[model samples]
Target: MVRILTSFVWLLICFSCAPKEESIVQQMEAKGPIPHPTEAPDQWLLAHIDVETTGLLPGYHEMIDIGIVMTTLEGTFIDSLFLRIQPAHPERLSPGARAVNAFDAHKWAQLGALNRSAAVDSIISFHKRAAGDNHVLMVAYNSHFDSAFLDHLFRSANKTWREMYYYFILDIPSMAWGLGLKDLNSAWIMDRYQVKDEPHIADQHTGITGAMVNVRIYKALLQYRQDLLAAVPVP
Candidate 1:
């Protein structure tokens, strides 16, 4: 009888300690909607992203730096990310871009190995955590070029970004057009919004700074939308 009771107790403990099995989606649903990442400036958490490339093309040119800043939805800057990379050689620095960023090719050569794949992984991981399962709007001054470059990199990486299904990339220039406004240059947005003290220079081609500029631009655009909505009279 004592042995039988012990066996039953062990059975109870085993059942109680059993791990529950659920699909990834089921687990996500149980956790409720993941918090949406703040890609634009607003009253809540916001993320500003930028990148500096060796040239116009991402894969062929290489990314030298990546920058991001997090702020409140109210436009108050909070945290920031400024990472420098060492890309492979033969990276042609445009005379125009070189004039601003002033990165000495010889100096940059000392940084270390070029890990573009690792950089992309970092972006994907960060986006996944920040945006959760919800799609986050990826805004760029010219998303066409930036987006295409990103696509090329991801496709070359042997990882499919489609698994996430949580990316919403929008070009600010295009957004302006969609709003029936002419294409606004980054400088124009900066000047109009008076976002001089935000971070980064538009001409320097510093990826980090460029991303920060995009964030500010995104905020300004949002404000523009609000103004438009306010201006229109209700039917």
Candidate 2:
């Protein structure tokens, strides 16, 4: 009987693990393998996105703030967006996180009640409008964390973020390593590019500031890659 029960449970788990059906948007977003760009290099757009949450893990945490800064191959700020949402699960806020983000009790209540679905809808719409046909190279400082949270949020909203994102996420930390900048970060990029108006707090502490830092970092990385390529030997 125990063996039979174990087999039944295993079968149930396998059923649960089956991949979800792909949505129509997801189908449309799929692309074939892209060929390498010519020496001139195709224009690459970068979107610096940041999110301040009540806790560390996505699906488990509540997002308090969100920001996005968009730039082109040349690093010019084409557009930006910032929004603060009332935390859905106020109790989720950790003391350390609150202190870092400075979202005290008073500050929290000031944002007033927010419609979570409406907020997500508005942002998703904005993201679509901003992105258009232009492929966005997302440049979050720690994209693993931010992307996980965003994915969780979209899942919670009954929407697949991968569909909206076109199934591509160019995380900054990984990009940093690609540029031989392992252990380097937003502050390093700022100093490398001599960017003015440094923030007093950590990038993750303030969503807007974090987004701006990501934008700057993308620019620095692009310039770094260009210089590196220029230094390469040719036949």
Candidate 3:
């Protein structure tokens, strides 16, 4: 009887693990690889994004703030969006993160704070409006850290993260490294290009400010790439 029950449980497990029908998007994704950032489409929306979290605890962190600045490839501003997400776990705020983000006990109750679903909706709406038929590139200073948090945010919010942004994320460090920047810090590269901003102190380093910093860094990197190509003698 025990053997029969085990077999029944095994069958149930296999049934639950079976793949479901793929959506159209999933089918399309399976067809080909996503485009790389270097291969810009005819029209593309570049969104410089930044997020401030409760901590650096990977999936455990709660996003306390978000900033997005959308624009064309030439840096023509399109739209900007900012959100303060009410933390699901305000108690998770670390000492360092608390100091950097500067969130107080009353901060989450402010008029700007949105719940996770609303925050996700706001981001999707902004990106879609700016993108249209153009590809969207989510640009961040250090994409891995930001993207990991965002992925968790979306998953936790019951939203599809891919719908809001393209598959390829453009990282500033990659460009900095490619251009021979030894430090690989956004501030260092920005200083080299003379892109000035307010100091990254406690309360002053807002998400919007961080996003704008990313935009300047991206613009500077593009110019450097252009200069490199121009300086290279054609074979």
RMSD of each: 13.2, 5.2, 4.2
Candidates in order have lDDT scores of: 0.59, 0.69, 0.78
Candidate 3: tens digits of C-alpha lDDT, residues 39-72: 7555577888889998988678788888889988
TM-score of 3: 0.81
- TM-score: model 1 vs. ground truth: 0.61
Query: Which consecutive 10 residues in model 2 have the weakest lDDT in total?
Result: 34-43
Q: Lowest-scoring 10 consecutive residues by lDDT in candidate 1?
A: 19-28
lDDT per residue as tens, model 2, 44-100: 566778988888877777777778887765778877877776766777788777766
Best by TM-score: 3
- lDDT string for model 1 (128-206, tens) is 5655534434556665566665555555555544344334555667766776667466565557778653433544556
RMSD of 1: 13.2
Per-candidate TM-score against the hidden true structure: 0.61, 0.74, 0.81
1 or 3: which has the higher TM-score? 3
Q: Global CA lDDT of candidate 3, please?
A: 0.78
Comparing 2 with 3 on lDDT, the higher-scoring candidate is 3
Report the error of model 2 at residue 210, Å: 0.3
Better of 1 and 3 by lDDT: 3
Candidate 1 wrong stretches, greater than 4 Å: 1-48, 69-80, 109-114, 160-168, 186-189, 197-205
